[model samples]
Target: MSGNKIVAIIIVGLVHLLVGYALVTGLAYSATKKIIERVTTVDIDEPEPEKTEEPPPPPPDEAPPPPIVAPPPPININVAPPPVTVVDRPPPPAPVIPIARPAPPAPPAPPPAVSKARGVEPKGQSRWAARIQENYPARAVRSGTEGTVGVSVTVGPDGKVAACRVSSSSGSDVLDEAACDGMQRYARFDPALDDAGNPTSASWSTRIVYKLN
Candidate 1:
């Protein structure tokens, strides 16, 4: 019994030892396996932290759209007025006229006294003629003296002598002197008239007479 007990105890102890050894071996093996796994499996390149792709930043909030622009309103303009029209009016009619006139009467016939003697002077002479007669050269003719002479005389429109002059003498020297003296101092004549009753010019002749006083 005593040997059996001791053997049992030794067996028991061997079992315990075996158990501890087994536990220790198991632990060691587990530890070794973990180390090997850690060493072998360790990525020499560390996995980059999961790269989360940043979603594209949300599109920037659209700025409120600028207020819509509107086209300018069409401008209104005034139209010009039309031109004025001109109308032409006709002229008025002219007035009528009346006229009347009378005829003139005929002229009277001339008297017969005017036709009798165209060149004769009336018997009665003017006062100027009598003054001329009184101045005649009577003394020169009473002595039988005879003379011829030419005389220039101015006759007026009334047949009166305006002036008298002696210009030349006849061959009979005495007669010439007497005639010139008579004519220069004494002359008588009548006046003349034109058809229009106006005084006009005429010529007259007279014989120079030397008579006794």
Candidate 2:
């Protein structure tokens, strides 16, 4: 019986040893597998931090503007002239000594009138203007030009107007010529008488007035 017991105890001890050895060997194998896997894979890289940039400086300042000014006005000038000068001179000399002279001789005088009858003219106051109006020139009448003319006339011994002359102008040559021509052509006279009562030639002066009314 004791031998049986001892053998049984040895069998138990052997079983225990076997169990502890199996446990330790399993743990060591798991640790060595993890280390091998970590070593084998490559390490992952992280991205670099992002870079920051600064802003540009501000622009420079500008200069100020200039001031304005106005111009001046012009001036006027006046000048006076100098005065004139007067000069003196000596007086003139007197006249020379007088020289006497005689006067001119007197002209001859007409003889004294013989004792006789004096000269006489015709007896009536004449209406001679009627003759001038009746024969007035057509041109003068139409033009309405009026004037007065003085004529010297010669009356023949037959009591007629022998000649007529215009002594003064009537302001027109045409009017003056017409007056002398009319007198010579149409005028008549009763003639004059000398101291012996005989017909004689005489000179007479007359005037004719031409008027519209």
Candidate 3:
């Protein structure tokens, strides 16, 4: 029996709480509606959209003033040219220039002198030896008896004896000297020539043979 009493109390408390929540929710909704109605009134006016009118275009410009016409160029009539007067003008004098003549070539130099010692032919088949013998004969020497001496001579272009030396000794100085002396008197030769055909100096050599008996 006590358990039945406690259950009845719990059900009665739930029903009272539900009734309080419903009353509070209805009051809050009514207040919100009243505030909305006051803020948005039916007497408030809305603005109308503005009408836009386009301006008419300016009157068309009078056709551009006609282009100014340029005056025509003056007529060009050519007058007859004045008579041409020909003044006499003497032609310029010709220039006088002296012509130059080339100088005459110098006379060619004389042919080169030849050696007197080179061209001579001995007098005989044994002319060279004969000549030497005639000049020196046999002569006494440091050695027991003297014999003939032979020599060779080199002659230069100036007819001068360049060199004379003993070729075969006669064991005698005197004989050698004699042979050389002969050459100095008898040798003669023609000068040689250069590429230009001009005579050039030259040298020549010859042997002088000497004999005894």
Candidate 4:
């Protein structure tokens, strides 16, 4: 079929022909026999073509470079300024409570009540005139120097006259002296009473009328 195969067949035919001719002529039989013995059949087999294993290359269309995204660690924006609250300033507002000012000291306790005075008259006051007349100055009666002598007598706590003085002059020294002298000698009174009703010294003022008959 191919030219190389045809050429190889022709060469092998020529070798066989030469060997037969040498044997028939007996020119070199032994040599020819040796040549025939040495001739080996060559098998010419064309090797099969190698198989091509194409088509694993189409996956590289260029989109594999997007996976290196390490960029999200910087967004803190600096908001750390709100932590300074040291609150001890709240004690000043509590002193506004109007301290009740103690009712203006209860009006100074109204000054302990003083007892009202009651009048207490002396007893045996009438006997003073008769006693004073009995001791009238004889000189006043002789001279006819009549006058009303007003005298203040201090009665003792025991109701006897303790002191006497002329409260009003009689225009006669004799009558004035007689009035005080007589009242102090024989006059009597019931001693006055204080608010507690205890006997206290009393002062009595009265007049003595000296008349000459």
Q: How close is candidate 4 to the true structure, as a TM-score?
A: 0.43
Question: Between prediction 1 and prediction 2, which has the larger lDDT?
Answer: 2
> Which model is ahead, 3 or 4, in terms of lDDT?
4
Per-residue lDDT of candidate 3, residues 46-96 (tens digit): 899899999999998888778889999998698788998786997799999
lDDT for each candidate structure: 0.59, 0.76, 0.63, 0.77
Query: What does candidate 4's lDDT look like per residue over 60-157, in tens digits?
Result: 57766777778778888988888787887665655566666655555555676565433335566567677778776878767777888888888777
Between candidates 1 and 3, which one is better according to lDDT?
Answer: 3
Question: Can you give the lDDT of residue 209 in candidate 1?
Answer: 36
When summed lDDT is taken over every stretch of 10 residues in candidate 2, the lowest stretch is 116-125
If candidate 1 were superposed on the true structure by all CA atoms, what would the RMSD be?
A: 38.7
Give the candidate number with the greatest lDDT. Answer: 4
What range of 10 consecutive residues in model 1 has the weakest lDDT sum?
115-124
**Model 2 Cα lDDT, one tens digit per residue, 1-213:** 699999999999999999988989988999989999988876889999888776777776666666666666755556566887765965677878888787878877988866444332433325555676566767877998888999888888887778888887788777888888877766777777787767888887878877767
Model 4 regions lying over 4 Å from their true place: 1-120
State model 3's lDDT: 0.63
Which parts of model 2 are misplaced by more than 4 Å?
Answer: 1-125
